[model samples]
Target: MDVAASPTSGPATPAGPDSAWMLREAEQFIELFYGEGNGQGGPAARMAEIRAEVAGTGTYTHTVDELAFGARVAWRNSNRCIGRLYWRSLWVRDRRDISDAAGIGTESVKHLVEAGGGGRIRPTITVFAPDRPDAPGPHIHNEQLIRYAGYPQPDGTVLGDPRNVGVTELALRRGWRGAGTRFDVLPLVIETARDGIELFELPPEAVLEVELSHPRYPWFAGLGLRWHAVPVISAMNLEIGGIRYPAAPFNGWYMGTEIGARNLGDTDRYDLLPVVAAKMALDTSSNATLWRDRALVELNVAVLHSFDRAGVKITDHHTESNRFITHLEREEEAGRTCPTDWSWIVPPVSGSATLVFHRYYDDADLRPNYLRRECPVEGGPDRT
Candidate 1:
């Protein structure tokens, strides 16, 4: 059974027998992950070895190549993710041997730095230790490696990202003293079944952030808008076949809406819509005048322009939407059905303006998918 990691404490394990389903999943993953070029021996020999390992008392360790391929395929099978077109490009780091909290924190910085790519953000994933036959795997309590803190002010308004207010409160209760700033990066929380939990402060070099600015409007830089360069999702379960790896973290270059539309413009987030709109001298009298929409477009323009000027890797919704169609066509040629969630695939700001908005997509979980797990928090599963 999968373990639930809480923000307040360590993870809890629910014991379950190793069943035939796990073996079947392992077999499926081995076949799919290895493909034609398996190992030095052969695919048949490798499959036999995997089967023996699964059937035996000791746990099986995936070959280096298997780990890499499995991670890439997991990205490919993520139906809710609109960025699967570049799934094959994922760089996977196999850290299955690491179980200590300190090791995870140290290596996670490497994960961040490598994924940062010195401004050219890369799509990457790191596979940590898997849940063993007797115990649960170590878990990352933070939703992401880098996230802005939310400080609840006396006026009942959050001083930072409002969406993270609850988690920030939990962190404070757990002895995390934030800088009380709008963009304070949260500390790394690692919860283990054996050692309980520990905390690690992120080093300065591990985080690559960009200051937001407009190309023409100099005042936009004065708004003090900025965002982290990479989004390292740290809480998803990487399911290859039937095996679940709870501590695996992955990342990708951010889409423009992820910054401009939702993170900054959302009402509960930074809520910069009214602020940006007023600065642009747009009519704030009513919603019918499209002032909010116009402001949103300009905000997105600043995001794209800033990232571009900084030499970071980012894709616009229109370009990515067209690429999704291209991905579908390629999948069709390969006789594979492409599973997509329309609500997420469409751009948050300009849903009707994008091509992905007008299409119907089949919802399917083919294989080797990354699954969203229910966190210990009460408000359902947390997104990383």
Candidate 2:
């Protein structure tokens, strides 16, 4: 319900049944959210208690405000969720012709709605729930899309709980890509392999696909990053650890598109999502053999799925490691040298996996060459 301020100056106290009911409602709401078997208290009953307590304190007039605050606290506490979605847009401002940019925010979101190919993004919202069964061709741009993130509150606001980061800052960091005021909205998608918690995007398009492989039997231990076209630069590429990786070809699983126009005449506004795919790397300090001390490589790829200029379909993409491996394999087949003992560090929270580097070659004269020496060096064993 839309919250409204009360006319009375002082707070109003809740009565016997009234106060009890409110508390019950709150508790029930919590139950529906976190799902059953989550070990949380019942929703209907809990709301009653909160109502009675507030009434006893004589702060009933502020019920609306309290309810809003309580709802947020309730959601955060029970859901274990964080983050938000944001949006803004750039348009040529002919101050001489029109002096307002009131509809830009609405328009930006509209584009994503019409595009409509970002998985369950546009269709599953509660607002659009009724129209689902027999709805004719795409009706009123569905506004039901939900956004979530790792952090619930903003930076200045305290997030005493450390499960996630500040929602506002995450939104702003990405929202800056869009011009004008930022809205608190997020995309609804869950990255698997990682916990199936709903993820939030700062006004992302539709589908974001991120993959990080370590080239080993258990391949979940690498750190890689992925990107779709932001609202700025036309084409983009990624360079990490002195290695350059190619963008997904023809937008394979993750398509490509034209970066959006610039804002404030900066010509540098681009939109993209950068996620730190959490994972734990191998711990080798305990052993003394080469296998024990080998450095672990970590790869994380996060795709901030959103919309392209055309607003026709959801974009898809893969992380850099896959692209790098494809290139490395080709080079080896051509008798070119490559690196060895490659390892990745997957964060512990997200689970663990490993990437093994097997093939070794030698070609010191070539640029960007990482060859493994076969014979020992002047003072020690071969260290190519």
Candidate 3:
């Protein structure tokens, strides 16, 4: 059963470029698609059909092959991703016909189950209905499908993941209450014009999680640290050939530092360094002691160890960094310029040690990319 009534109609498509701009973007993308030898028909023929469709309906539909190719290339063009070495392996779930909240919720759960792949995590994406001139597509309120709820306490501390306080509060406003646990998975919030807003709780089978533990220190498990296995990013809009899929959710397997060095170790987030340091009996007296750095290394070690022990597919920063270099070389050999954001490509924990840290890259704003979506809920902080 659905948590809320499915909206019969979606919101009107948000204001964007005029028809001329759409046609121009469409022409460029179609040319690229055909140029890459991925198109079934001739480029000129496709463009002519696209032009006619735009003149009549303001937009054209992408063939299934075109959609899949475009999504793969988007990952290839993603400047910040370090795992683009396997971008072509991304499993695309095209659900362009599903615009209702209930259908989206169902498909999202299925996405988690399939993408999680029972610990052999697969890089995947689920593309939903795209925004059209007549109507907009559905919107996913959570930044990721499996984020923990953050309950703001009266003492000015957050009980759960502090980064999710805004989303947690938004869930509360919609009359959805979590179990009040630090690891309570927030409900999936879906919005459309006809239904306004709807909440759907993800089933446990769909949320595969790994408990954090250390191979060397047994005390690490006592911290009660755990994280969802699959990180399905749901808030970003995907643009292909000027068509906007506002509710596309995608995921890549976790990199160790993402969990240990940033999510858990960051001062604004879980801030587990001091706790880990105390557990390790490290002196927190001075900066010269490097207690925080030591603690961070151990934390990251625990993360990599835990995921490995759990039989989950996770990549360590060093290995992923090397793979990125290989991908860069491959792209260059293919006569393509690999656009990279050095700051993002470099791992957070050991910046200098990683191969990606030393190189400068072409940081171009390429089309057919994932974009930050405008927040649908007023006053809600953008999580991504």
**Candidate 3 structure lDDT:** 0.82
- Candidate 2 Cα outliers beyond 4 Å, as residue runs: 1-148, 152-167, 170-327, 335-341, 345-384
* Candidate 3 or 1, higher TM-score: 3
Runs in model 1 lying further than 4 Å from the true structure: 1-17, 34-44, 378-384
lDDT tens digits, residues 329-355, model 3? 999999987878776777788889989
Q: Lowest summed-lDDT stretch of 10 residues in model 2? A: 1-10
Which stretches in model 3 have alpha-carbon errors above 4 Å?
1-14, 376-384
Q: Taking the candidates one at a time, how many backbone clashes does each contain?
A: 0, 60, 0
Per-model lDDT: 0.75, 0.23, 0.82
lDDT of 3 at 18: 81
Query: Which candidate comes out best when scored by TM-score?
Result: 3
Model 1, range 1-384, lDDT digits (tens) per residue? Answer: 001110111122223535566666677776765563555755667767767887785456677877777777766656666677777788888899898899999999999999899987888788888887877788886777787778888888988877676667767778989887899887877888888867788988999988899997899999988888888878677766566688887888877887888889888778898998889999889889999899999999999999888898877878877877888788788777777777667778788988889989887766676666666532223322
- Largest lDDT belongs to which candidate? 3
Per-residue lDDT of model 2, residues 305-326, tens digit only: 2232223333221222233346
